[model samples]
Target: MHRSLFNILSGRNTRQGLWGLPLLVALLISLWLTVETTQFATAENLFNLVAQAMPLIIAAIGQLVVVLIGGLDLSVGSVISFTTAVLALDQPAIVLIPAVFLLAALIGLINGLAITRFNVHPIIATLSTQYIVLGITRILRPVSGGTVPEIVIAAVSGSFLGIPYPVFWGIVVIVAAWKLLYGSRYGLHLFAIGGGIASGAESAARNFGVSDRRNIILAYMVCSCFAAVAGVFLAGRIVSGDPNVGLLFELDTVTAVALGGTQLSGGIGSLHGTVIGALVMALLANGMNLANVSPFVQTAIKGGILLAVVGLQSRKKMGL
Candidate 1:
């Protein structure tokens, strides 16, 4: 029994990575917050916490998809911002909502094409797209003043059976992601592709009849669509468009992904791990806010946590 527990905790011989460690960390953080503040465990605050973390959770799931194939999407934040900008445009919900996702898909397609077909590095290609999209978003909403569709607003603003809509939103997103990543053939192909790349055999999966190019492109498209979903959630909560709303989100999502025990080199991760990792981040942010810590300090702390987490991984596994 003891050995079995250790294997579970250690993630021995498992592709799920070191998720148990983050689960422990999340529990510890929750315990600390519960003990440290009178308001931390209050129902209102708990609901607020779930609402605040929903966007990151959704976006990180998308990030996880890309990371599984040993790729990164720096454009996630920009895509998110762009989505809100589009949603807030002077248009009908029918037109704006579909347009937002369509644009996001296009952005992802471009990013994928640049990397896969043009032989561009993932970082460079996504970074360039990030700038382009951010520029366009800024042009659309210079200072966060446009109104989002009423339906979008309504979707996030109420409660159902004593539970906030954001909680339901999270459940839906998590279930969908679980289906895509664990229950689908595409998800299996993703792991297979990523594993081969991580092992320095990029063509290994291809030898098994997988179309790496198409799958990788679809992964990027999926990532952008997920980011769009996050943006929609944020738009409803904020009730308006804010070009800067998604600022630094890419950093946070990547940090959350890494914290969740997803390998930077790819092919090793779990959805539960990512959720746990995001909860840890959200918990820390909530705790620090309650303690009256400066936002700057919190940002620095996040950067430090990211660095430490990445630093702990073996350079070989990181493909460095």
Candidate 2:
């Protein structure tokens, strides 16, 4: 009975109406925390917050594409970590940077293909790939250290005025992605593909009447590209390609996306929501750390928040 009720309610537009919740909740949390803490509102503090969050934003952007195709790319975190390790190879700036982005895209492509061809769920396929990629990276590097060119560091860490470059990049990517992911025709299909693939597939697919056959490929492609960019951006900021980079990033990115009201079941989303969600995630994390919460406890809080929000959406849709 419970499962039937959930299935019935799950078929609604809960994603569209919840865009502002993340921002509002984040604001309240930040304000409450800031009122009690001195570091929450400082320009320096803001700069650091944005800087630390750049990777999450970047990874989430990539993950957004994966989500759009009604697929999850769990391997992305491992991919990011792998790319970071590659960047730590101490290669020339020109060579290392390009390689990172390309590799990321390749991994995404492989993920898409693996899912499509192997008749496997994206979660399972990517999970398997995640292990493989992590193993390879660990066997090859086993540690993290590399020097990003000074210019690269300045571009990501430092800012033009008082603003950090990280914030600027986030804004730029958010705008561009908003325009590309939500403001265009193809973007519309991505959303529709998740709602009702059988009814909508004929319109969305060109080859075999599947909703977004090409789009599925492209979605994974975009996800991987962003993952690569995130890896490089972090490497530039950190000035090293640490082996441990992006550990558990998939959980954070997925949580942010889900928190932004993108349905885990797929076929709905907004980049704007994702942007707000990323900010919320950063604030939640920062606030927790500043409060000196235990890492395990913080993880519990994060997971709980996701579960609670998803539960609310589920119940609301059921007319509860």
Candidate 3:
């Protein structure tokens, strides 16, 4: 029993990475919050917390898809902002919803092609796309005005059987992501490609007939689509469009991924870990708000967490 517990906590010989540590951190934070704040344990607050974290949870999952194959998508925030802007346009829901995802796919395709075909670094490619998308998003909405479709609003708000719709949204997204990451042949290919890249053998997966380039490209497209989904959820919540709504979301998603024990070098992660990491972040934010911490300080604290988490990674795991 002792040995099993130790192995579980240490994540010994596991490709899932050090998720156990984050799980413990999340529990500790929750306990502390519950003890420190009367509001923290309340039903309303707990539900609200889930709702507040849903967007990050969704975007982080998308980031995880790319990270699994040793890639990144800095443009996700911009994609999200662009999505909200498009959804808020004076257009019908059928047209606007499909258009949002279509544009996101195009953005992802461009990022993927630049990196795979043109040999552009993932960061540089996505960052460039980030600026371009943000520019277009600003052009679309200049400011946080205009209305999202009523259906979009309805999907995110309200409850069923005393549970908020956001809860259902999260469940559906999580279930779908779980299926894609763990229940598909493509998922296996992703880990294979990422493993090769992390091990300094970029062609390793290709040698095995994995078609690394195509899979990597698909990963980016999946990332952008997920970001668009988050954007739609956010637009519904805010009931409008805001160019800056997704500002720093890239940072948050990356941090959450790293915090969850997903190696920056890629090919080693778990969905549950990512979700737990996101929950930890949400808990911290909730606690900080309850403590009246300044938003600037919260941002700084988050940055510090990201730095510390990444810094703690071994040079071998980072492929440095």
Candidate 4:
């Protein structure tokens, strides 16, 4: 009886802790808004916040996949910039989106190859790719200005069947990610690969599970493709491909992943959790903006929160 009671208590505690992050974020958002102007909850402002969240959430999801594999993609922001520049340059439909995504994927694949084949660290490999990608983007489109096509403006700014396009895109990607993470063999491989490449492969190799090397490459490729998609949406939002765009996107992406309970050391977490973490971040930023928090102070606060959350999570693991 004592053992059964302990088990039930333990399970309940675990469930409560699991909800800590989301609860905290919800509370913060409420407090922030409550103290702000009464107009903060207007429909227009809510829609605006959703619009603003699209790019960050999209980019952050890409980061989430790579991080799960015990790797990082510092080049994401640069990829976004480059893709945006490519779109801004304007090409035929057949040539534009596909070509840009392919280019980004190739670049990400190269990063993966460098890490797995050449044995470079993910940080170093991706950082090198960041510079290379940025250099290319700059050379191709030095000027920040670009014309916004009417179709894109309407698609992004307008709702489809009364759903905000950005929100719709976010839901679609989230659902696709959920299916991939939960329903596919590739998803199982994702968790296994993070456990330690050799151990994961040797154990799962009996079934001829996913190649760790290939998965590493795929993680980066998926990351880059999402980054490209995010770039296009951002360009639409800004109505131009600003050369300085995607600045610090890497930082936000990493923070969201970490706060979502994915260990920096790698090998754990779910897409659902990470998506919620990103929404928390978006709400925090939007709420702060509405509350008139200074941008510099906002950065400091976010950094502090990240540090606290990481430290707490690390301790939790240690306790386990």
lDDT agreement with native, every candidate: 0.91, 0.74, 0.92, 0.75
Better of 1 and 4 by TM-score: 1
What's the count of clashing pairs in each model shown?
0, 2, 0, 0
Candidate 1 backbone collisions, by pair: none
| lDDT per residue (tens digit) for residues 135-252 in model 1 | 9999999999787999999999999899999999999999999999999999999999998888888999999999999999999999999999999999999988889998989889
Q: Using lDDT as the measure, which candidate wins?
A: 3
- Best-to-worst lDDT order: 3, 1, 4, 2
Off by over 4 Å in 4: 1-20, 197-209, 315-320
Q: How many angstroms is residue 81 displaced in model 4 relative to the true structure, after the best TM-score fit?
A: 1.0
Per-model TM values vs. the true structure: 0.98, 0.88, 0.98, 0.87
* Consecutive 10-residue window with the lowest summed lDDT within model 1: 311-320
Worst 10 residues of 3 by lDDT: 311-320
Error of 2 at 8 (Å): 22
Which stretches in model 2 have alpha-carbon errors above 4 Å? Answer: 1-17, 198-211, 315-320
TM-score of 2: 0.88
Better of 2 and 3 by TM-score: 3
How many collisions between residues are there in candidate 1? 0
lDDT (10s digit) by residue, model 4, range 1-320: 77655543232333112224554676677677866668667787778878887888888888977877778889999999998788777665456767778998898889889987998988999999999989988887797977655566666878877778888878887887778777888877777776553233333532565678888889899998888888888877877666668777888888777766666555666565576667778888887787788989888877886787667653222211
